[model samples]
Target chain A: MGPVELGDQQMVAIQTRNLSRTFDEVVAVDDLDLEVHTGEVYGFLGPNGAGKSTTINMLLGFVPPSDGSGTVLGHDIATESLALRRRTGVLPEDFGVYDRLTARKHVEFAIETKAADDDPEVLLERVGLADAIDRKAGGFSKGMAQRLALAMALAGDPDLLLLDEPSTGLDPNGAREMRSIIRQEVDRGATVFFSSHILGQVEAICDRVGVLREGRLVAEDTIEGLRSEFDSAARLIVTIDEPTDDIVTAVRSTAGVVDVRIEEADIVVSLERDDRKAPVINAIEDAGGTITDITSADPSLEDLFAALTTDGDGTDLGVSSRNRSPGRPRATEGDA
Target chain B: MTWLHVAKKDFHDAGRSRLLWVLTALLVLLVAGVAAIPYVLAAATNDPTPTFESGLTFLFSPIGFLIPIIGLAVGYRSIVGERESGSIRFLLGLPNSREDVLLGKVVGRTGVVTVPIVIGFAVGGVVIAALYQGFDGLDYLGLLLFTVVMGLVYVAIAVGISASVSTRGKALGLVITVYAVVDWFWTFIPMSLYWILERSFPGFEDLPAWYLLLERLSPGQALSAISLTLIDTFGAGDVDLTAAGRVAGDVPFYLETWFAWVIVLGWIVVPLAVGYLRFRSALLN
Candidate 1:
């Protein structure tokens, strides 16, 4: 191939075509064509054993692809891995720290490995571990350890960042802080590709998401594009002052309403379009229903993920059922 | 090379470990304590003229046993521990190739073995000089250098096994088997072959060049072969200690004492190359 142009490199940060990998008889990642644009937060979403880590491992050359090819930051993923890693940072999944080394030392090792002139203190501070910079990593909590790994990943101000399950062990507040740091990196004009099993975590930050199911790319789209395409039906919960059997019947008869039910004192209206929200509200009011509260309940990425991943038999789509980060609200999932 | 960074980091991390301190203390005691044994023995038997050569001869077996243990102890956990602890992700997550991590472990762990060895010999050298007559400083330094080279060989072997295996138990098992075979039971190979070839147990004298070569092939024997020449004999018993004296006729070049340096060099290079090849293609998934 001729020398790649600068515009082509700037146009795409990561691109993989027909990538496949299998361990013995079990396919880990299959014929996957994945693309992440420069300066975008692309969320690689999947449950446990969905081959998310395997894909990243192949991209980083930790594991070779059984078939096909890929590139990261205009470098071939297989041949130019070290050069790619030099310019791109990675926070790997289930990564452990050197217990003997202090937080600063870990970042220093990364800086030294990259031959970068970054001050270890500044990197550690960026990850919000400045207070524990001098402390041994053995004493750091799980959240603190994750932050330290992030600091090391940030050592060289890399052009692209591959973060695999970056919020795995963090508390709600710790996760928010990490997300903000990610935003800052994005602001620095770095492309960020992060993976997560939990969709709520990426719902706020991801510009686009790709869902992996049984080693296949089931869906890849912008967040809004995903919601509108996969889920034309949205649950609109309308709470009234009194019991609402009449309102439920009235909303069920509305033009775009799919299903309507009186769930306690609230009329749970499933509509075919978001515009149906206004018509359902009008229908309820015409039926003498006094509306006290209205919740649109557009399918959270969680619901969209479930709809795309599960089959009619629900014969194990391989998505994790447990919603982690207990403090995040799951009330939206009740009628979803 | 990136391996240099990995080595520096490995050494820096190992310096903070309790294992290094413990190794240093043990080597100090073994070196100094073994040196004084020859003097104590001569005084008890009323032949109280232990030279530095005699003192080192007394020191050889213990050094042989202790150095390999120190080497294995430092090297066995180098890579496998990172795999088990999941810290290998951090190591390889950076720009380091697998060769870098493997080579770094070898050099870093060799440094770990070197620290206590240099300290132990320094402390033991003073004790040996004061306790024994005819203390040859240059010869003592030769023995010290040979022991450090031996440390590198054992560390290479241990690091090789550490890199090849997936778990700590497998690495430890391979290391123990290797040490036991090379250090203790290597005679079985030559002895069994001799029995098959000549139909009798061979004596020390008039042994075929191949037979002696087989015996010299083990890492422990090959290392001691180099060390034996580095020290002066002092003509105590006028014993024929050279390899030429044991062969049935004129010695072959392979049986020469200098050839053991080649063997020792092979021990250092072969295991590391094998481990690097295996680790290079290893899927860190």
Candidate 2:
């Protein structure tokens, strides 16, 4: 199917319009606009120090915006922040839990404070923390602590969940488990807004993704759309019976084939589009070659993300750009 | 309701800490040692000079120093520790109002610290009664009540400092410095000023009005006044009507000293209110 079209009927769980936070002369979040619909997992993609956390902090009302305003769960982000806090849960990038309190007590205290009726043991079990429920959090491993943090965020059965780099310390299986829990939460109609440096996880779980660079959002679209937009180059891998110079020359001479590289018994050809597959096959046949096998490769999310967040000159979005006008948001529509 | 939950959690958590138990034990020992000193002194000295009032005076002097120390220790890390631990974000992110959290913490910590002070005073009062065989019940009650109030005022001041400072170390240092200045130096300054004013100015027989103001500035001085009142009420033995005439007149006049109570209550309320306001405005992310 094509990119899932978000409809207006989907309530906006979070919406920030021209939100900005500045510390003295440094702008941490500059004219950032974001929207996350109900039951959607919006992945905020950025590297360290990319202002993703700052934007999340603004949404959580931990920091007030220096410029514009936003709303969380239909509550004003500024004036009615307490009401917003009631319906929202946050797992910060850094894990900080009480060292002396048991996991059960910690979750219990959080639930009690929020006036939530959920059983702490049940919540802990949901996060795979039931075994360590009675143990103090000081001895918890990083993954375990992350899970506990997630459990704390879920204490009140909040409608909106904000996770910052939730998969940072997880092993492969733990990461998979986290994805499943995220999916479960989404299935239960909870909107998840998470930030991550990894592209594969975002591609796997995020329904919509926004890329932030140097305090501004440089790109925002569905994962498929982002990949398709920057997908100008494709790969054609063909396993041939024999390595011959004529076959290589024929394949390289095709109209759309840009580069060729040989690995063992296979010839890898770079093409502009999948339609170029036919001409390359025809050219190989004309060179008296038989195609053993063929596979088409497209750009991954990592590649598209890298291209969109970096300038033509290869300067990363986190760096100052000479081409970028002062106070102007970076244009992302026609980049690829 | 959230405040009640927060208070219960804080109280339970604080109760579990070994440091709190150690501090309480130390306070009890200190009070015990001070209370026994009078009896020990009276027994050892054959001069027959140290009476019950002398013992009362001796005990009152050191209890004054201990009160402010307990106040500072109990309150210096109240909010700053939470900020450092990062659990504060979890609490502040809840629907509960910051004011409720602040006030609840104040109540919780005060309860934890004041328990030992009350027990110490009660033990001291019992010791005074048993050792001297002439102790005043009303005097002991008043002294115990005054010590608790002194503790409340100092705790409020320390909490205010804690809320204003970002680090526990800074809060501890500031509370200690302020306590030392107000409890020790402020008392001496007013008395010295009173002596100088009396010697230098003619018709200055009436203590300078500033003297009373400055004296009241010290929590120790307030404790001293309360202790003296307690001793007067309990230790006096004569009951002659004419002799009690001046005493009766002064008793009624002293009872109308509403300004003293106002100052003491202000000491508790003003700093606490300021701390709550500052804490509510704090950025805990």
Candidate 3:
């Protein structure tokens, strides 16, 4: 295949075609195609055992591909791995840091190894690790350790950043800081590719997302595109001053109204299109029912992810379901 | 340049490990204790004449076994531990070649092992010089160099095993078995053959060259040769040259400096080459 160019106008920074990895009898990544653009935070969304880490490993040259190829930043992933590695920084999901070295030393070693000119102290401060920089990493808490790992990855000021669950062990405030840092890096014209099962975080940071299920890229699109595609139905929750049979009848009579359910005093009407809102409001007023409150709920990215990733049997989303309990809001296009 | 950075980092990191310091101290104590045996024996006997041969034999006797143990300790975890701890990926991610990584590790770890051995020998040599009254700096240097070379051989073998194996236990087991078979059991093969020659055939006084070559293959035999030379210098009892020693003697071997140099060079080069090859193909991830 000819070299795939990352265009100057286009944001595309990573492109893969038919990339596959097989270990003996099992295929880890199969016929996968992906594109992550420059200054874009692409979230690799997958459940546990969904080949997310395996794909990342291949991208980083930790493992070789069984078939096909790709390029990162115009460098061939297979043949020019060293050059790619030099320009790319990765924070692996599995935590592995030098136990004997302090956090500062680990970052310094990473920077030195990469021949980077940045000061490690500044990187440590940015990662919120300035206080713990002098302490050995063995005593670090899980979140602290992950922060240090992220610091190490960012040490070289790499052009491409690959973070696997970058906010895995962070608190709400820490997760917010991580999102801001990712945004700052992207603002500097770097591409950020990260994987996470946290739908909220992905929605907060990722410009686009790719969903993998059962070793395949089941879905890939911008978060906005996914929201538009999967949340084809919108719901309007309306609270009226008084319940009336005519209001229900009028809402049902409106064009583009799919379903309406009354819970307590609110009429939850599912719309076939976003334009149905004006017609539904006219219909309700025509029936002489005064509207007290009206709210439109768009489908989240998490909802789209759930609908797209579930097996036909209606079981197993294949990502980490632990810590993420049932009834948590699924990601939609409009989430922060 | 990247390799140098990695090597420097590895040296500093391993140096900071308390386990490394403890291991170095233990090795020094063991070597010093072993070297003091002859002195203690001579002092007990009230014989101020500490023969060079006895000193050589005493010092060289434990080397074959001790050197391999040192090798096992230093090398069995070099690659495997890094792999387990996830640091191997970081190392491999660098632009440096795998050979550099393996060689740097071997050099760094060898340094860790060799420093104590040298200090121990220096300390032992001083005690022997002060107490025994007859001191040959050249002989002591030769023996020290030989021991270090022997240490390198084990380091290489251990590193090769470490690169090939996934677990420390398996690498340790393989190293110990190889060391035992090569150092101890291989000698029995030549001895048993000689016994057969002496008893089964009368007037078979001429021994084959291959039998002598077989004995030299055992690092213990090579170390014993150096020990015998040291013993002779100290006026100690004679170290009998077995079939291998006789072949070494008949050849233009420099017992003092040249022979020691050859043995030491062989120990360092051969194992390192094998280790480098194995490590190059290792799937450290």
Q: DockQ order of candidates, best first?
A: 1, 2, 3
Candidate 2 TM-score for chain A: 0.73
lDDT of each: 0.84, 0.73, 0.72
Question: Which docking class does model 1 fall in?
Answer: medium
Candidate number with the higher TM-score (1 or 2): 1
RMSD for each model, in Å, please? 6.2, 9.1, 7.3
Which ranges in model 2 have alpha carbons more than 4 Å from their true place? A1-7, A232-298, A310-336, B45-58, B118-142, B188-205, B222-256
- Which candidate number has the best DockQ? 1
User: TM-scores of the models, in the given order?
Assistant: 0.86, 0.78, 0.79
DockQ for candidate 1: 0.72
True contacts kept of 1: 0.89
Off by over 4 Å in 1: A1-10, A230-298, A312-336, B233-237
Per-residue lDDT of candidate 2, residues B37-118 (tens digit): 7678767985554455566656665667777887778888887887887767776766666777777777877777777877
Order of candidates by lDDT, top first?
1, 2, 3
| Model 3, span A113-197: residue lDDT tens | 7888878889999999988879988788879988887887887788899898888789999999999999999898788999876
Evaluate residue A216 in candidate 3 and report its C-alpha lDDT on the 0 to 100 scale: 85
Least well predicted 10-residue stretch by lDDT in candidate 1 chain B = B232-241
Estimate, for each residue in B169-227, the C-alpha lDDT of model 3 and write its tens digit.
Answer: 88778878887787668878877787777665322234456565556656666655555
